[model samples]
Target: MSGSDTVFNVKPGGALHGAVRVAGDKSISHRSIMLGSLAEGVTEVNGFLEGDDCLATMNAFRAMGVSIDHHGEGWVRIEGAGLKGLQKPAGPLDLGNSGTSMRLLAGICAGQDFDVTLTGDASLSKRPMRRVTEPLEAMGARIETAAGGTPPLKIAGGHLLKGMDYVLPMASAQVKSCVLLAGMYAEGETCTTEPAPTRDHTERMLNGFGYSVQRQGARACLQGGGKLTAARIDVPADISSAAFFMVGASIAPNSDITLENVGINPTRDGVITILREMGANIEVLNPREVCGEPVADIRVRAARLQGIAIPEAQVPLAIDEFPAIFVAAACAEGTTVLTGAEELRVKESDRIQVMADGLQALGISAEPTPDGIRIQGGQPGAGTVQSHGDHRISMSFAMAALRARGEIIIEDCANVNTSFPGFVELAASCGLNISQN
Candidate 1:
């Protein structure tokens, strides 16, 4: 994970069977410590993501004078500094490659009195912050940015942010969470509406912390100035993380595997829906509530998958999984066309072009559209694939490479550490012959 490139060697496999638990829900893990550090008392979080990105967020908050302690294992105790208590850190908060941290922190900073400036790693710095900053300004916060509306945001001393019923041009969890966090300190009812739904981890976590947040239609209404209370949360397994397994089982012939503790939040279940629509045998087993979010064990069995047109409505739900979805598309019975998903261009990579390019290199006919991709499905061809320095793209092709008619090699695999840190291990455990070469 510390070099110029990492490589993945994926071997074909037989049916896969086992129960594996992934890292904690990354979205909820970020919000827990954040909301906890600002609540009235200490919040206990179990199953927190130990990933680099969430750790960056934790470190940034600690620099602001909040108290957070790691317990035995997979547990964290965050002491609330209370609302309006985050002192300015001595330096620019370095959010290394985490757009989640950069965007969510932008909103949190909007209501603070301290003079704070938010910065990020090379990749994070390149992501557009204007989406979050634009809304913050309408709330009466002063924010300055660089050209292209990217990061290294200069946030002046906070102001009395007024709550507004802002409408989002795009459906993004980061943007929605940013506005909701800012609403915590606003003076009135703060609300946000999106053209389409995104992840609602913040709203669920806030309710778990005893804050009353109501959702109306596409909008979430938050009563400003309501203090968050101490609570215990067991972060569910990340659905995004589980997506790798779903695609792995769905494509590997005769495979059946179960991923435990997966978060089944309605907004994040797009991957499951799309795969089931393609005729994969996946079952949601022992579904229950942990804290306030839904959790389940998902069992996936490999089958002959048939392609179907992916609706634009489902785009917002499965936005992050298209790289892997494209893998499913490659093996589906017919042409799979995806539309109304232009956001894929701005992720860790231009997923549309990167996937289409990589698939083409493997002899699959894939074309990147302005909004999405169209693919001709069949047996995967043989060739080397590039990850484009994007974690999901790297892993998606690694899985796609498994079904290749020839040995598959993936370049630039170190990016997998950003989200799913031990991704190669997870793949190997699932019976794929994967190695770091």
Candidate 2:
């Protein structure tokens, strides 16, 4: 978890079995710390993601004088700092590889009384911050990004922000959440109209904290100067993390596995929908709600998948799960065509290109387009692939080894801890012949 030189060696031929629970939802874990620190009372969180990214969020709040106690194993207590209570940090906030932390915090810092600078590691530094910064600037916050609209985002504080009705240039929950977070300190109502529906965790969590976010069709609107009241949050297992094994069980022979307590928030369930459309045998068992998010146990069995044209509408819904979905496409019986996912080009890596490159290295026919990719179903042949330090890419290829004809070695997998910690150990326990070095 501490080095960027980690490698994963996965041997071919294994069937995933038994029940497994992934780490808490990364997106929700992030928002919990952000909103909790801004609330008026103490907040207790269960199933919090202890990944490096969420820890970065916690450390950021702590640097601003918030007290967060980690009870270990997915439990956290946040002593709220209240609105207008956050202090100026002693130095720049280093977010490591967490774009979520950097982007969302940019909006929060924009409305602060003290100047704040948000920074990140190399990968995150290259990601586009203008998507959030431009919108926040429109709301009357002074934000300066690096050349070409990247990070270390310098937000000049003490500006009285005035909210505006904004239209998102793209479908992004982070951008939407950023503007909305900044709106809390604005002088008027802030509204975001998305071209397509993205995750609504921010809206849902705001309601949980006794803040009102109005939803009408594709638009979410909230007035400024609202108070956030502390509440208990139970973060569900991240479906994105569960996706690797879900694809593994679907592709590997005699594999049957149940993923427990996973978040099935409708906005984020496109991965399941896409997989099911590809002929995956997945069942939603014990569907329920937890902490304003849908939760369920997912049981997936080995099935002969036949790839189809991925529905464009589901693109924004499962944006982060496409890496694993690509692996499923490789093992399926026909070609998988994905489009309306240009967002993939700007993630931890150019996921569209990275996944295509990895799949091709393993002897799969993959062609990357500007927005998406077309993958031909086939058995993967062994080869070393580069993960570009992308956690999802690393895990996706590891699962690909299940159907590989030879050993698969993945390079630069140290970033796996950014999202899914203990992934190798958990995958190994579930019968994936994977080892970390």
Candidate 3:
């Protein structure tokens, strides 16, 4: 669907029931493309994210001299170029709106002895590149970017990259993974300390693929110069994407939702913990392990939600899910306050300001902070919302509208196709009252 034609109009509830399975995990989907392309032999990935962002990584790898064949039925076969074997692309690689592709690939390109230009879609071009660029530059990679560390980054190779210690200013998986990917070719041990822990999929996947990586306390260290071997990876359903449904079932009157095959990696399970604390009856069942990541079935039943303060330390874990979380807060019994999360300002949009605006448009009282938003919970008076071209923003508030007083329409909803391609259909299947406008 074209971006302009994407608007979702959601009606009030048909209360949720039955178990629904989400698609592949977004984090694992990204790593599968990246690591598989650099391995020594053929790698097979099952349950990979077929969304635009992961697809951008696959296309970027193809342009960089990796042989990849997409056989029908969710299976991708990659004949890797081996570590240090990537060829320079013939022209500037376009990354669409995927920050994951640009950041992780920056490290891949830096390790090679070739020069390359990388550009992205308008949205990607605006996201801060410094998070990844700063760390790469510290490792002897030369990168020049637009003013204030935005994209259209020009990275020239040939510098001798020596791994060094880096302390992350914030919890960012992309930045952490970028440094680690470059460290794979560096001359010595590379280590990073975080202000708080972020998603550790890259670290775990590296270990699963036969690379020696160790994590201790707040630090994750990698022994540089190890070759990655091809391995099969099974991506669990994304907990981030499943958040909307969780919120939906939590707020919709008398609804009970079972979300199956969802990832419950501790670093990204803050939503569950926070929701459970808010008095939502959510249960995790059938816990299992896949490729070192925990997978579980989530069951959430509607209840009277009571909002509480979210700690600064937990901000990064639930950062991407906050917009929808605010929608959850709007229907809770008290006020929800969040802090220490300035990162939300630079996501697909200025999420703090945008979410505040959307909530106000819905007749829900919302206050904005320099870093976060505070939402006062009560019954919402319905109105149309603008997603600002953000997928999470589109689906999250749409769930909120399910229990709202009147009709709710989300404009510029095309971004949902980029991540959750069947969002509208899946919501409908879960007994949600939703449709595309």
RMSD of each: 1.4, 0.9, 1.2
lDDT (10s digit) by residue, model 1, range 1-437: 44255788876545567889977778888888899998888889999888778888899999999989976356999989887779999998998878899899999988899888888767777888899999999999999898999889999885889899889999998999999999988889889999998988888888888888899879899988888889988889999988978998888887889999899999989998999989988999999988878899999988888988997788989988889999989978899999999998888778899899989988899988899899999878777888777888878887775577876788887767767777788778878778986
User: Compared with the true structure, what per-residue lDDT tens digits does model 2 show for residues 70-142?
Assistant: 9779989999999899999999999999999998898889889999899999999999998998888888888
Candidate 2: deviation at residue 33, Å? 0.4
Report lDDT (Cα) of residue 114, candidate 1: 85
TM-score of each: 0.97, 0.99, 0.98
Q: What is the C-alpha lDDT of each candidate?
A: 0.86, 0.94, 0.86
Rank candidates by TM-score, best first.
2, 3, 1
Runs in model 2 deviating more than 4 A are: 1-3
Q: Higher-lDDT candidate among 1 and 2?
A: 2
Error of 2 at 40 (Å): 0.7
Candidate 2 TM-score versus the reference: 0.99
Query: Any runs in candidate 3 off by more than 4 Å, and if so which?
Result: none
Candidate that would win on TM-score: 2
Off by over 4 Å in 1: 1-3
lDDT for 5 (candidate 2): 76
